[model samples]
Target: MPFTPITAEQRFVLDHVVRVRELAATERFAAASDDVIDAVLEGVGAFAAGEWAPLLRAGDTVGARWTPEGVRMPDGYAEAYHDYVDGGWGTIGVPEAHGGQGLPFAIQTAVLDTLGTANMAFALCPTLTVGAIEALAHHGSAEQQRLYLPHLATGAWTGTMNLTEPQAGSDVGALRTTATPLGDGTWRIKGTKIFISFGDHDMAENIVHLVLARTPDAPVGTKGISLFLVPKFRLDEDGRPGAANDVRVVSIEHKMGLHASPTCVLSFGDHDDCVGELIGPEHGGMRAMFTMMNNARLNVGLQGVQAAEAATQAAVAYALERVQSARAGGTSRDAVRIVEHPDVRRMLMRMKAQTQAARALVYYAAGQVDRAGSGDARARGRLELVTPLAKAHGTDLGNEVASLGIQVHGGMGYIEETGAAQFFRDVRITSIYEGTNGIQAADLVGRKLALGREASGGGVFAELIADMRDEAQDARLIALIDACEATGQALADASTDDRLAASYPFLTMVSVATCGWLMERQGRAATDDAPFMRMKRACVRFYLEQIVPEALGLVAAAQAPADVLYAVEAELFAE
Candidate 1:
């Protein structure tokens, strides 16, 4: 099957759902005129489809190989990456001052959406680098920015966020990575960071690691943690990658998918000389790291969109070509394309609708980021509220759609040769990383909900519901919005145990309603009734009629008492 960049879909989302024109209207993003935006979408789409798509099969099969020297990427990856850099794809969202195109973040996300759909494992390299650029742009000292931001913004050097340790999986407070201040401005970073993606790759000349560590006199927990800029190679006076830093790839994880992305166990200062500069103030690591993490979270959500898009494309192509049985109710007895069958049609429609919904959700969030960057306080709060939804539910949709893609393929999907299974394996990690989807749910109820309240009198969540109410005319969407409101209010008064228990379901209800709202808006925008518009209208109809109603059942789950969840004794679970 062939993989084409969802260029038309992305353009539609940007034009209608995300409204990139509004971003262009802002003085900061004035350069992102319609012409420039379209060119970017078309150019990146062509580059991704022509350059990266070819590497997808080999990325899964050959993967990235590791040795003492470094992790060698799949063949043609270096050349493709060079072209990616040379083509200026990585510079879309970076600031003009940093040698970039200075476009809206949503446009950059569009680039990743296309490329990741082509080759997700390969796309992870630039994803983390974008996060690093953001972190440095926000928190790094002026000298640090001058020294590093240019190379990073240009994609000459890649970046990695090193937060995970063997024991500190989700608990950042438990990390034991130590950063001792030298008499000079730098510090010695020592500890092992596990599951560092693109931690050591040959794609760039140097890797800038944003590491989280604690100082000698710092307090315990995340409050005491600090962020460090630890590069693979120390820069000389001229700011080029000079001597090798003490960071070493202990080994890369042999994972279920994304094999081409080397998930590394990195040993920093193994010989006791890894040098790093403090990114922000002492004991401000968590705050600084969040700058990077927040950026990555949205990109991770986009990864979900990427996977969904890829899987949907493959499954749809497969459904149209594979002959199976006659239609459920048809005149001919002869076998027809599987797509003619009602059940397969159902599966294909679900995949397409869900993929579009997820893409809209992510693009909407990216639009909020751009607005927030342009000094929209309301958009900032909205961005905060929607980030988790986009990260968790978007990825959740990815997993669900990928699984459905496999089901649509029947048994051929079970075998690796058909290439349907790779989407599932690669996307499975999206829900688990950046912060597990469960953790994202917890953050939604525990933090974002309250923050939204503080930021606005009724809070951003309420504002979202209000926006949906204003935009939506469908009764199903309206009903879901009402249910979301009820659950949100109830959870606000609930106990910690209750809140956590209902968090996942509540997140789902809110996500589906929000996506449904966006889908309705997209439906309204497609009034011309062209073939694409008709299909858009159809998918929106299916989503509201079939998918939106599913959220109704979750209302009970979202309001379920926590006692039932804890009723059974934990010790007897093994029985």
Candidate 2:
């Protein structure tokens, strides 16, 4: 059912702007010579429209079934897995030397967008696999690399990060998993890991778990944690599967959404000798693990993109199909479609603008990821600054877009059969899971801001603002750039005193303000590009005018001490 009224702005972003191939012509953006992104997208579209899309409802309705053996995923997931792996979709971003296609994350992001949109449950497995591969590729030993990389790269085996415990949650320092050194170079791991994705599955022959545990007599707190590569099945010298290791899937989480994803609770060394190889050096697991976590966060950000785009698509379809009563300007005899209503237009427009802007941000960041390898260290640091922002903000945008999607449907949205409610439930966890939005804000202020503080000798986030301003292409983009500067300046001024706590609201405002600002930049860059470029420019205008205005209040709130948020008695409102 389509909306009764559709605004011109909403039409542009929702109906006109194409998928991930928008900036595929950008040379540095393409990881593969062929249209790998389009190819994957095409496959995803076919699968989604046919086999996979049908599962979306089943996933939400039926969810996953838990049994003594493990969580039984929806039917046909293994068959889907065979196609996904055999098609090379799983290894798009892995290095070519390790038997992967070594595609750029941008291309992979597009593919992922399709996969998640098709059936989010199915996407979680490979997303976690890519994260584990990232950790191993960066920190694994040569022997470890030779043993695991090929299989990981080829999608012949899957991987998991054994992080959370029953009591640990997001705090890694509280984990009590122990890794005892054996006489040989191997180690025996013993402990339980909760919420592990694809923890135990017959999808693949082996599962490589990058586990964090402590050595005996090690220093207390996070400093003592070490990362180990513990496999569900040990690999032989030739990298093939050897003996089954001592790991068992005790149970799986019965989550509200992503039902196809098996959230497993794994018990390691329930026997006595679970052999595991160490990744990187001892007591340095935190650093190595962060590599995976950060990469995973970025992937999580793209999952937001997936949700936003999918929701946008669904909203547009609903708006066009649903024929409601006449608009205020029209009589019942001359009844207009609900898309003709102004308020409906406003909601859809904001949704379209924000979603497209997020896509542009992540796409550019994807380019930056490629440039980081070939560019200077400063170039690399700049990429690092955008990483958290993209991950944090992109996912936030997902929820916002999905919410708007629900709003567009109104009464019908509340109905479970409409599927609008499902989108809302699925995207809700993005912000909380990958280190809460609060955590992302603190990292930006502490780590990235600390770097800016040292370099400028005083001003924080100023260089970025200045660089953005200078890149402005037209009068409007420049004006919006100035507004972001004012926002950034307010944040800088608020942080003048060394004892001051930086307001997260300020960080959030500037983050959105910058996103609005960059959308304009992207629009301007597309001057010579395509209809997609025109769509981008139009959305940029919408973001600058509609989205950034919301920042005014947040900037005002940033003037206050951060302790105010902390001081609030959260428990008082619990009831």
Candidate 3:
């Protein structure tokens, strides 16, 4: 099945669940009228479905290759990227002062969903660029912004975040990359950054690399790190890309999936003289990088949602066409479509409900970002609280749904030709990158919940639980909310090690309960007697009765003692 943009579903979530209209009422997004939003959705949907979707299979099959010149993309990718740039799709949420459309991030989130569903590998390039745009717009000096923002916003120049090295995967403080000051207000950046996506791609004129490195006399850990704006090509007096910089793409990683995206190993200043300018205050790289990290994390969650959507579509399409077992009760001897079977139907419903639930949560979080843009402190806190859940649960759903997609195809799914396995392969990365799901769970329990009350005037988790309880009209939903509240309180009261042990299950419970809340709202708001609304009602019903109950077990698992996890001796497994 060709990729289709879920425009109606996106609009429904934006209007009913996310309340984008309320966001529009704010001064920051007041100019984003209904027509503007609709136009963007329609245009991007067409571009994604027509231009980008066709390249999906080719991208996976042909993939990207590293050459002596640069990282060469798959066939038709450069053309598609050019079309993306020409269409102005890259600038939806960027500020107008930087030659962008200046729309709300909620709208941008919807656009990203469409793009990601069409082709995740292609979508990743823009994803990193958006993060870099956020970092520069928030922390870059005026001169730096003037020099970089326009092309970046316009997609003429792409960007990459360089924080990880061979030794520093998640523990960024352990990185050994270095930067030395030059007398001309520039620094020479010397380091090897691994897993740098789009690090040396040929689609754009210049690649703006935001690097994290420590100064010579700086302290030993992350506190000593500083951010640098190092372009692939140095700028001339006219501010255009001029000479080649000292950044080299040593090689690209051959990954399990998203092969078309070049995950490069970058070497900077191997012979010295890689000029870079400081982004923010010295020794404050982590603070500035968080701006990008936060943006990318939510976008990664949306990647999960998109992959699930794509997988579900393919599975349903296959189930309808592939004839298999006979009808359970009928007299007919002919084999019926597998979709008619009870188990297949159950699997399909599970896929649909989980995907919709993830979509609602992510869109709601995006709406909170828009509110935060308007200086709403509570909304900001709410966003921070939900970020981990959105990242962890959403990707988990992606993996689950994709696996189900393969099962729906039965024997054919195991073969690469069926296309069902591709989703499973592609979605596996969403949980690992942008910080692993385990890291996200830890952040939720150890950091967010621990300090949420002091930062936001009230506990974020507590406030969300209360909101869910208030909105939950069904008894089951209310019960689920209560369970989530109790688990959250336990996390609050538990010791650090206990909280860490419980973090994963607690995060899962939060995601399920929150989805139940949003689904209930979606059900209430969907009043039409149309088929789509009927499907919405059925999906929400299945989610509440069949899916939400998983939270009960998660709650129990979350409160288990930490000692249980480490009780076994390390060498005993070998025996």
Candidate 4:
């Protein structure tokens, strides 16, 4: 099945669900008119389908190869990347001063969804660059910005984030990478970083690595960490690539999926000459890195939405064409399309409903991000409340939907040739990277819900629940809203350890309920004349009746005592 961009669904969410035009009314994004936004969606959708989608299978089959020279991408990848730069798709949301279009982040996310759906491996490169752009724009010094932002924003050069190491995976404080002050406005960085995506690629003129390392005499743990800008090549007086830096790609990891993406182990200052410049204040690296992490987290969530959408599209197409047994009630002896089968229809409906719900959740978060940029306190609070749920639940939804897509294809899906299995393999990592779904759940329960000034006295979730209640026009929606409100209060009152014990379930409960709210709103706004609207109505109904009810059980599981979770002794595994 050929990949389609689902621009109609995207436009519906932007217009009715996310209300993106409200962002256009702001002075910061006033130039992003309706016409410009639509044109951008159309252009990027075409490019993704025509130029990038063709590379999806080849990328998986050929993968990226590592030579002594560097990492070489699969065929047509370089050309596609160059076309991406030439088309100006990478800089739609970057600031105008950085040689970009200065559009809203919502538009950028919409494009990301299209590109990610078309080709996730290729899309990973630009996703990292966008995160790097966000970090630099927020924390870089004037000289640093002047030297790097233009090329990075224009996609002439690419960027990577380096944080994980052999000794430190999620525990950043355990990293052994060190940065020694050069005493001349630079530092000598030396250490090994692992799992660096797009770490070494031949797709650009240069690569800028945003690295986290510790300075001598710095305090222990994450507090001691500092961020540095380590380029693959040393810059000349003219500010272009000149000589090789001390960084080397030791090896790239062979992963379960995303074969085309080079996950490299990078050794910095192996030759004792790798120089780096501080990105922000010394010992403030964690703070600065969060800017990039937060950006990446949201994009990761969108990747989930994209994966679900892609899988659903493939499964639906396959179901309609793959003739099987005769329809259950039909008099004809001839076989009917599998789509007419009740089980297949149920699976497709689940896939479609879940994908649409996740998309709406992600787009709503994007809208809040745009508002947060304009210094809306409430929007910022809502963003903080939703980020964890969006990241964890959205990716979880992706894995679920992809698995269902596989089931919809039966034995054919298990075969790699059908491309259904590829979606399942590729989307599995979305739950693991950019902070695991487990970490996301912990963040939601531990930090985000803690009552404090930063949380605006813990009213953000409460306010959102109130909004859901007010928006509920249908009886089913109102019942769901009431259940959500009760669950929210229970979660708020739970002890920290108790919350952590049930964190995953709690996150699921919140996510399902939030999606129900959005889908209800979408149902109300949908016009009934078109087939698309009728499909939307059916999806909404399926979601509410078959899916949203799961929240009730999740809420009960989330409030269960922590002791029960630990009742199973460790020795039981020995048997």
Task: Report backbone clashes per prediction.
Answer: 0, 18, 0, 0
Error of 1 at 260 (Å): 1.0
What is the descending lDDT order?
1, 3, 4, 2
Question: Per-residue lDDT for 256 in model 1?
Answer: 94
Q: What are the per-residue Cα lDDT tens digits for candidate 1 across 1-575?
A: 47987778899999988898888888899999988988998999899989999999999999998899989998999999999999989899999998888999999999999999999989999999999999999999999999998899879999999999999999999999999989899999999999999999898999999999989989999999999999999999899999999999999999999998999999999899899999989999889889899999999999999999899999989988898877769999899999998888898899999999999999999999999988899999999999999999999999999999999999999999999999999999999999999999999999888775764689888898899999899999999999999899999999999999999999999999999999999999988868988989999999999999998889989999899978899987889
TM-score of each: 0.99, 0.88, 0.98, 0.98
lDDT of 3 at 568: 89
Superposed model 1: Cα runs more than 4 Å off: none
lDDT of 4 at 276: 96
Each model's lDDT comes to 0.93, 0.72, 0.90, 0.90
lDDT: the better of candidates 2 and 4: 4
Worst 10 residues of 1 by lDDT: 447-456
**Best-performing candidate as measured by lDDT:** 1
TM-score of 2: 0.88
Of 3 and 4, the candidate ahead on lDDT is: 3
Model 2, CA-based lDDT: 0.72
Question: lDDT tens digits, residues 183-300, model 4?
Answer: 9999999999999999999889999999999999999999999999999998999999989999999999998889989999999998899999999999999999999999899999
Q: Which stretches of candidate 2 lie over 4 Å from their true place?
A: 1-31, 34-51, 452-460, 473-502, 525-534, 563-575
Ranking by TM-score: 1, 3, 4, 2
